[model samples]
Target chain A: QQQVKQSPQSLIVQKGGISIINCAYENTAFDYFPWYQQFPGKGPALLIAIRPDVSEKKEGRFTISFNKSAKQFSLHIMDSQPGDSATYFCAASSEAAGNKLTFGGGTRVLVKP
Target chain B: DTEVTQTPKHLVMGMTNKKSLKCEQHMGHRAMYWYKQKAKKPPELMFVYSYEKLSINESVPSRFSPECPNSSLLNLHLHALQPEDSALYLCASSQDHWTYSGNTIYFGEGSWLTVV
Candidate 1:
C-alpha cells in the first residue's frame, strides 16, 4: 500500500515542553522522509528530512527519529514555544514514484504559553 | 532565490468563469508540481511537470489544465469549477525529479481559490 499513517490527530503542549508526532509508512520503497510545518493560510515548508540510512537527525530544536525496521518515524520539537504551534505533516517519497511525496494526515499542534 | 511565487493570492470566480493560477521560480529548478489542498487536509498531487514537459496527471479532471510554458513558469487553468473545488492551490518546484538529492521541493504561498 502506498500510504503513510500519522498519529495524534492533534496535540496540546506547554511552552518549554516537547511535542512529538509519529508516522508509519507501508511502502518499503520509500527512502526519503521529510517533515513539513505549515501555518494558517500558508504553504507547507520543508522543516527537516532524513534518509533511512540514519536513525536520527537533529537540527536545533527540531529532530527526526527514524526506525527503518519498523517503518516508523517521528518528529520531536524540544523547548516548544507558542510560535511552534502549527500543523505538521510527515511525507515519504521514493525514486520509483519520481520522487513524488506521499503526505500523511497532518497533526495540529498547539503550544500554550 | 529559493522561492516559488504565485499570483492572485485570492480569487473568487463563478462556475462558468475561466481563470488561471500562475507560479514562477528562479531557483533554476526543473521539476514543478501542482497540488490541491482542502481545509485541514494534506495537499493532493494534481500534476507534475519536468523539464518543461508534463509528466504526471494523477488522473485529474480536464477542467483543471496545467501548463509549463518554460522551465521557470507553471500555470493552472481552471474552468467550470464547482463550489466544492474551492481550496488552496499550491505550486511547488524541485531541482530535479530524476535525482533524489535534488528532490527537496519548495512550495509557494499558494492561491486561495473560491468558486462561487
Candidate 2:
C-alpha cells in the first residue's frame, strides 16, 4: 500500500505567486514529515522538515502546514521564482520504523518569470 | 569533501555482464543508504547501512547486492540485471542512525544505470 499520497502531479505558477502542494498519509505511525527538492539528473535534497508536534514550519520562502488530526500536510512556496522550479517530494518516517522514509509520487513545478 | 561522491555518472552494461556502482562520503556519517529511482517516480529504498553494518534490506532482489566496505564507502554489485532495472541510483548518508529527530541526510548527484 502507498504510504503517502501527493496531489497535482504537476504545477505551474508565475513569478511572485504562491505555489502549493498537498499530501496525505494513512499511517498514523509516521511522526516525521519532510519535503525534498530535486532537479533534473540530480539527487533529491531535503528542503524543510516538520514533526507531528508542530502545526506549521517555515524557512525562507518555503512553508509546511501540517494537520495532525486529518493526517495531511501541504507545502507552500511564497514569492515563487523561476529557479524554484523542480520536482518536489513529500516523505514521512518514524523512529519505530528505523527512520526508513516512505515518499510520495512527486510533483513537477514550473515557475514562469 | 563535505558531500557524497558517486563514481561512473553513467553506465551501460549487458545482461550477462557484472558491474559495480561505488559511493563515498566524507561527512563522518555512520549511516548510509542506497535508493533507486525511475523516471517520473520517487526513490525507492534498496539498502541501509549503519555504522558500517547492514541494518535494513528492503526485500531487494538477489541480483542486486549492497556492501559497506567501510563507514565512508558503499557499493552495489549488479549481475544479470534486466532492462526494467535501469534507473538512477542514489547514495545518501546521515549521522549515526539512532535518532530520527534532528537527523538530516545528504545525497550524492546519483549514478544513472542502464541495463541492456
Candidate 3:
C-alpha cells in the first residue's frame, strides 16, 4: 500500500507562473515532510522541508505549506522558470519508523519559457 | 563536505557476474541507506545502516548483500542477479537514526546498473 499519495502525475506551467504540487499521506505518525527536486541522470536534491510545528515555510522561491490536521502538504514554486523544470517528490518520515522516508508518486513539472 | 559519493556511475553485467557498488559520505552522518529506483519511479528502500551497523533490511533478496565497513563507508554486493533487478542504486545518509524532526537525508548521485 502506498502510504503517501501525490496528485497530478505531471504538470506544465508558463514561465513566471506558479507550480503547485500536493501530496497526502495516511500515516499520522509522520511529522517530517520534505520536498526533493531531481533532474535527469542526477540525484534528488533536497529543496525544502517543513515540520508539523509550522503551517508554512518558505525558502527563496520554494514554499511548503503543511497541514498537520489534514495530513497533507503541498509544494509551491513561485515564478517558475524553465530551469526549474524537474521531477518533484514529496516524502514523509516518522522517527518511530526508524526514520525511513516514505515517498509519494513523483510529480514531473515542466516550465515553458 | 556534505556529499555522499557513489562509485561506478554506470555498470553493465551479465547474469553470472559479480559486482559491487561503493558509497562514501563525509558529513559525519550516522545513518546510511540504500534505495533502488526504476525509471520514472520513486526510490524503494533496500537497506539501512546506522553507526556502521546494519539496522534495517527490507527483506531484500540474498542476491543483494550490504556491508558497512566503517562509519563513512557502505557497500552493496551484487551476484547472480536477474534482469529484473537492473535499476538505479541510490545511497543516502542522515545525521542520526530515530529522530523525529529536523533530520534531513541526503542522497548521492545513483549508480545505474544493468543486468543482462
Candidate 4:
C-alpha cells in the first residue's frame, strides 16, 4: 500500500523562484513528518521535519508547511538555486511502527540557472 | 563525525553467491534500519534493529537476513538473491524509537548491489 503520495513526479524551476512540492498521507497514525534530499549516487539526508503540533517550520531557505487535520504537508524552497536541484522525498513515521518511515515516491526538482 | 558507514560501495555477484553488506554508526543511536531503493523509487524498509536487537522485519524474504551484532554495527546477509534484488542497500540510524520524539534519521552512502 502506498501510505503516502507525492505529486508532480518531476519539477523544473528557475533560479530565484519558489520550488514547492506537495505530499499527503492516508494514515493518521503518522505523527512525525520529515523531508529528505538525495543527490545522485548518494544516500538521502534529512533536510527538514515537522510534527503535528506546528503548522510551519523554516530552516534557512527551506520551509515545511504542515496541516494536521488535512493530513497533508509541503516543502517550499525559497529563492531556489541550482544547488537545490535534487530529488526530495516526504516521509512519515508513527510511534507504533518504531521509527520505520513510510516514504513518498519522490519529486525530482531541477533548478535551472 | 555523526555518520552511518557502509562497505563495498558497489558489488556484482552471481545469483548463487553469498555476500554480506556491513554498516556501522557511532552517533550513540540505539535504532538502526536497512532500506532498499530501486531506480526512481523511494526507499523501502526491510529491517530495523533497536538496541542491538531485531525489532521490525517488514516481511522481507528469508533470502535476506539482518544481523545486529552490537549497538554500533548492522549487517545484511544476501544469499541466492534474484536479479530483481539488485538495488541500493541503505543503512540508517536514529535515536530510540520509543521516545516518540522526532529524531532525524541519518543515512550512509549505501552499498550498490547488482545480482546476476
Q: Which 10-residue window in model 2 chain B sums to the lowest lDDT?
A: B96-105
Lowest-sum lDDT 10-residue window in model 3 chain B: B96-105
TM-score of chain A of 1: 0.98
Q: lDDT tens string, model 4, A1-113?
A: 89999987999999999999999999998989999999988999999999989999999999999988888999999999999999999999988775778899999999999
Deviation (Å) of A46 in candidate 1: 0.3
| CA lDDT of every candidate | 0.94, 0.93, 0.92, 0.92
Per-residue accuracy of model 3 over B1-116 as CA lDDT, tens digit each? 33999998999999999999999998999999999999999999999998888999999999999999999999999999999999999999999876554578899999999999
Candidate 1 C-alpha lDDT tens digits along A26-78: 98999999999999989999999999999999999999999999999999999
Error of 2 at B98 (Å): 3.4
Note the DockQ of each predicted structure: 0.69, 0.68, 0.72, 0.69
Local distance difference test, candidate 4: 0.92
Q: Relative to the unseen true structure, what is the C-alpha lDDT of residue A23 in candidate 3, on a scale of 0 to 100?
A: 98
CAPRI classification of candidate 4: medium
Backbone clash total, candidate 2: 0
The predicted structure with the larger DockQ, 1 or 3, is 3
Looking at model 4 chain A, which ten-residue stretch has the lowest summed lDDT?
Answer: A93-102
List residue ranges in candidate 3 displaced over 4 A. Answer: none
User: In candidate 4, which residue ranges exceed 4 Å CA deviation?
Assistant: none
- All-Cα superposition RMSD per candidate: 1.2, 1.2, 1.2, 1.2
